[model samples]
Target: MKRSAAAFFVSVAVLAAGNGVRADGPDEHAGRAQEYILANDFDEARKELARGKPDDVGIATERARLALYEADCDGALVTLSSPDVAKTEQGAMLADIARGCARVTAANVLEEDHDQGVWIRYQDENDRALTPLIIETVVKAREALTRDLGATWPKPTRIVVVRDLLSLSAMTGLPYESAQTTGTVAVAKWGRVTLLSPRASIHGYSWRDTVAHELTHLAVTRATVDRAPLWLQEGVAKREEVRWREPGPFDDRPSPDAIAARGIELKLDLPLDKLGPSIAMLPSADAALVAFSEVASFVRFFASSTPPGSLERLFAALRDGKEPDSALEIASSGNLKQWDTKWRAYLQSKPKEPLPPLLSLGKEPAPNPKAPSLREVRERMRLAELLLARKHPTEALSELERLQLVGAAGAPQDDPSYRYLRGRVLMALADPGRTKEAEVLFQDPKEVLSSYGPWWALRGVLARSRNDEAIAEPSFAEAVATDPFDVEAACETLDADSPTPPSKDPSPLCQSARAWKVPSGTED
Candidate 1:
């Protein structure tokens, strides 16, 4: 075994090439080196960095972070003063942690567990407890992917769990903002997949689903040379996400009719050809969500309504080098314009079901001299609440806005409880412009006054919507504490809780939570 990360790196360096690389200059050298490091090609990364002999501190910093990746804390610390090292927050943190890492007596080493044809790489023995679950999920993911793709990945598929978004972004070339907006569970590169370590605490993502999602990506990328359009590829991947504990293997596809109904509500819905490049580039988080829903609905509907080989044939076309639109046209046996007409007709024919009742009725508004009485406000609010509860958010929002103008005294807009109601209505409307309004309302200083379970639950919802799950978890906890019966708060908080829904959560506030089942939804 190697004595230190430096020894391990040296061995890899020598194996990659006896001599190191030479570069034209530091900037290009550092950029190429970081690119290699991101790909986990440490040998080439080291070689690339060494080419410059790195007079610049900024260049030296890249080498330092690489050393840390190999757990060579002593080596990493030597370049702590380098400006290149201090260039990024991630680098500064790496420098700060180097000393503590050096003092640890235990040998820093990665552990591997292989079973069947799949293998997982963990940072150390700390993940031993999770290895069994990891292996189980890998096996399931491989099985599910193989079943769908009609091909077995004979070679070992490595699953590498990384430390944080910064590390993942560097490795994958995905920006941190894109990662958060897309709710990226894991990325499947050529030979292996990388996921955020369980320690990173991205609450609410399911490892099982993530493994399944990435496995599908790997298989599909291999099948199509990664040429499949983003929408179809993602639609196929979404189809692969299934809950492991279901009574038996279930398709797990959301009802196309229901999703289409949702699409009708959100006017931003696009046809298969128009789903756009990737979900990450969508204008808002709501647009991303709606886009995914529409594509998933379209793909599943097309498969069921058409011949079984339609999807397989589309992939085949892509494999044969046809463009995405052409492939889609071939799969549907009709042009996209024609398909759009059929899809629209299908959407209109499906039964319309109302969204679940989310708004609670309130007491009548009271009277005041300057404006409408509290009794009048409540009466109008009740009408709006009924509209919202009945799934008429557009009408509800209009009614609520009118109530706000009725008078200065006890205006619904001034009350946190009323503001919360309006926020929810805005969300139900799924309009991007309304999202900011909802955000302002949720962030109001008066939120603390309500202390009600629903109020806190809305606060959690707003936070989670912005990908601020850390803020969300505590609010969710507060909701559960205020009322243990609030299932939505309990479920939303599950991501930040145990890896699996706990049989017994330590918090007395959530004691009753153990008995509730987490509903199937895409948290990962």
Candidate 2:
């Protein structure tokens, strides 16, 4: 979790004293206002501030806090720049943070949507297609977390989707380098959730799941009144990220226990209590994934073995200022250390999955001795895509064949992009033999899931051709969910010969996709 801005209430109080502005004297209005702000009762906090002298230190700081809490960086800056508040050391620090946030959010706010207590912010017109998915995830998450964790929200959740890691850093105050290191795409901090746009990734990420995961952090903070420790916070968030959705292929593919078991076998797991401030600050993506899996598995174990309301009781204890270990003991009816031991033993019994490759994001390709070979591979892939786009499927096929040979030196055999492009080229050729080859390429559901969009769309098309409705529907849905910006995926229908299905409302993704310009012969 990103740290909250430094507490400026004390400094503001001192500054107020120097100005002979009495705030806590007879009515104690400022004191009560600060208490309300700390409890996240911004409305009540504002009321209390109204009751106090406008220029009172307590009133100004709490008002500023309320503005920051709502992600009103401009409003915060105005409050902090007040003559009395500006002189305080903490106020100056907070002003700097607000300025950074203002710079980052200014562009994203150009486009915005909100409903069902969720606000979505993004910059590009193309990303408008993603608003529905984000809103659906958050709405479901709110209901699920409230039912499971007894979490409540006093304000509408704000979500900002940025185009890059740099904006994510500026908005959240996490260093840009830290985000690149751990492949951190989203963070729930300050007062809102901020995430990287799926379009920014080389291959699209599980952006819907990511939004739910980050929102869970906000729910945890709300439930614990911001007192939950790092381990408890992360563990609970990971455990609940998938709770909003029905059981499906997309649900924690490797499973947390399996990943955690692998991490243990590889000696890559971090101690739950020792995971520093945020997993995003970990040295590498491998370390971050291991840490996430361990905490997620441990929390699942902890939640299951304990009584029905054990997690709620734990949240209550944390809110009441109990230490995390003591809170665990009270909720679980066992010592914290004993609970950890049992969880570890349980994890050992689960089937282990091999550790997946470490992910890299928002960074240039690392220096390689065989740079020319890598460049050739990239060039061939680019030329193949251009060739396929320009109705030169035969040429595209030749380029892909060369790419396959190049892979012999040292490239992944199952590179999803390679398989997806080759399949598309083969389909465009419309030869029975090549079409059969395309079908074979997309037969692996795991491989299809790993690709950005085209593979899933191709899978859907092939399945539809064979009248396999089961695979076609889900594959097309997954394709749209994976990369809605892709015109073909978004516009693809499960049954091309059938009339458009009637609906109370059409899908935003489809609407956006249909309106987008399609390259010639994209679906052939």
TM-score of each: 0.48, 0.79
Tens digit of per-residue lDDT, candidate 1, span 50-106 = 885557554676777667555566888887766655656656665655664454313
Best by TM-score: 2
Model 1 misplacement above 4 A: 1-111, 123-128, 198-203, 243-257, 356-524
* Overall local distance difference test of candidate 1: 0.55
**Model 2 alpha-carbon miss at residue 475, Å:** 1.9
State the weakest 10-residue window (summed lDDT) of model 1: 9-18
lDDT for each candidate structure: 0.55, 0.67
**Alpha-carbon runs more than 4 Å astray in model 2:** 1-39, 48-58, 87-89, 107-115, 356-383, 398-415, 447-451, 465-469, 493-524
Backbone clashes per model, in order? 10, 0
Candidate 1 lDDT at 75 equals: 85
